[model samples]
Target: MAAKATEKTNKRDFLNHLETYLSKRDGVDKLLKISRYATKIIIASSLIPETTGSLIPRLKSFESSVGVSRKAFRLGKFVQDINALRASRWESNHELVLLLIAYGGEGFYYFVEQFIWLTKSGLIDAKHSKLLQRISAWAELIGYVGSVSLKIRDLRKLKDEENCVASTIEISVSRGMAYEEEDEKMKKIKEKKTLKGLSIFQDLADGLMTIADIRDGKGMLSAPNVISSAGLFSAIVSTHKNWISC
Candidate 1:
């Protein structure tokens, strides 16, 4: 019991350190650049040409107009807004809430694009489409929850640091992380294991690769898009990893 409590305390300390480190002037500046570059890579790779008839604006409009309840549409719109905000430059505290939003939004959209295709594929192969949908549904949910909750937490922390009144939304993000699915949960375990703060940086490479695979599998990538995105992300992810190693 004591050991587990000590572990919890250590994780909290790590979070505090992470928040402090990222809040530095340089930290925020560098991350903003990183997010901008990442968004560009994703767009150039996946969206513009692939969905020629229905790119971002069109897809977003269609998604909003889908047969759904008012509440569902509102929720979907909120999710979509996060994606739009991700590309727009913004400041964030040490928690990197904005970066998390960009990430979650990116992941969500990637899966969404695939799901849209899967919807189209239903007429051709319902069985395969159903399987893909099942797999992506959980991933989409994770991306959504992780993205929004982290952003909310970051805002709350900012409020506290800036000399504000007490907050009411007491959703402990760390605790919530404990209950995430195993594959995602395992990443959290890895986070606690090293506590070096380098692994989070490594996630850039992993995420970009995941994006590439999904785009390719969905037959959404043109030859130019594939070559450009793969080369760009590989170079960037490699440079960062090398710097971290040194």
Candidate 2:
């Protein structure tokens, strides 16, 4: 009976968390991204046999619409980066370098994406879309590189801290002292390490997609299915992060 009650509580808590996650703008955007990439994967993959020619076009259209809608949803998102940059002005030089590259590059990418969205929406000349997309792709690539670098550096520091905390815990245990505080600290560090690792993975996946975009889908990593898979992976990681925060 207790086990069943615990299971019921867990389910209710999960539902509440999901409700909160889906309520936020970022959560909705990530969900849309997941849907968009999943649709792209279906359109690109052979899961839908050649005999089902009719579904391909429709799926492609849906993917395209979702892509445009995502951009629309992200309209003015560069403002967030602007705010981030402002808040980080007092950080260390090394931190500032990464922050500038990551936030500035992504900010510009988002800015240019607005133009691409306009072009796709027929509000602007189609001739300029390619150039804007190329610029956005490059900016995104740079941002991802900076983000991955920053996360790796942070992970290394976290590892060092974890080691120190472990040694302290060992000493405390040997001396028969209470180490609950150290244990709690270790848990927090491990959680941070996990999140940072996820961030790096997400950034790498996104970087692959950006590279594929810049290369016009002609290289080894530029296969349609590969791009879609990377996009979906990135989206899922981001959604997971957002969900946990929610």
Candidate 3:
């Protein structure tokens, strides 16, 4: 009877983790799509003439492509709006892209942070630990994407420096150097933050892995057995109900 109960608990924990994993994946996908659209809008507004007309149509197209509701779309717009407010004094392409990149980076960071919290809180179980691992992988991938996009922007700035050499060469050169320095600083900061986030994720992954390894090897481990049992499910359901009520 005890053995049968342990098996039942293990199965329940696995299913619970699976559900959480799927939900997190869906959330990540939605955010990634939103980020891509935001990037497009930032680039379009910066490069295209007649900002409002060009921006609105392209934004609409992106909206259609992403299939996000107006309310959800407004969230992306809110990030842009905040950036626009900040860059109101200096209207330029660089400002737009920087704001977009910062906003997107922060947004991704927050998402990962939330996932880390969820995992640490035991809201996520061993089976879902695998999903958390994947989430960490995705976070790294997103960081690389942001880095590449910033690099392209840097290259474009270099091209601009070459174009107007005679009149504003010295100033352009100085400005380019400043931009490069700033970019490097920002890149280092972002890398540091990403590493920190990855560290937290790795710690959580390690804990989950340890749990899994113990469960697989030991036929009966206290933590896994407790988490796998009906008691754990009951606690989860109760906590969820409380959350909904609150």
Which candidate should be chosen as best, given TM-score against the real structure?
Answer: 2
Clashing pairs in 3: 9-228, 9-229
Ranking by lDDT: 2, 1, 3
User: What local lDDT does model 2 show for residue 227?
Assistant: 90
Worst window of 10 by summed lDDT in candidate 1: 162-171
In the predicted model 1, the residue pairs found to clash are none
Put down candidate 2 lDDT per residue, 110-134, tens digits, no spaces.
9898999899899999999999999
- Global CA lDDT computed for model 1: 0.46
Q: Compute the lDDT of residue 78 as modeled in candidate 1.
A: 38
Candidate 1 stretches with Cα past 4 Å from truth are 1-102, 105-110, 113-124, 161-246
Judging by lDDT, tell me the better candidate of 2 and 3. Answer: 2
RMSD of 1: 19.0
Clashes of each: 0, 0, 2
TM per candidate: 0.26, 0.90, 0.26
Task: Kindly list the per-residue Cα lDDT of model 3 for residues 1-246, writing each as its tens digit.
Answer: 999999887664655554564364333343444444454544434454556556656655665544333223223333543464465442578755654554454355345545544554466564675565456445434444444454455555545544444334356566664345544554555544444444334334333433444344354432433322322233233333332222
Q: How close is candidate 1 to the true structure, as a TM-score?
A: 0.26
Could you give candidate 1's per-residue lDDT for residues 1-246 as a string of tens digits? 999999887664655555764665334433443444454455555655655565655543443333111112222433454665556454556335545555555455554544445455353465565466445544544454444454455445444443321121123343453333444544544434343233333343334444544465454443445534554554455445433332
Off by over 4 Å in 2: 1-15, 89-92
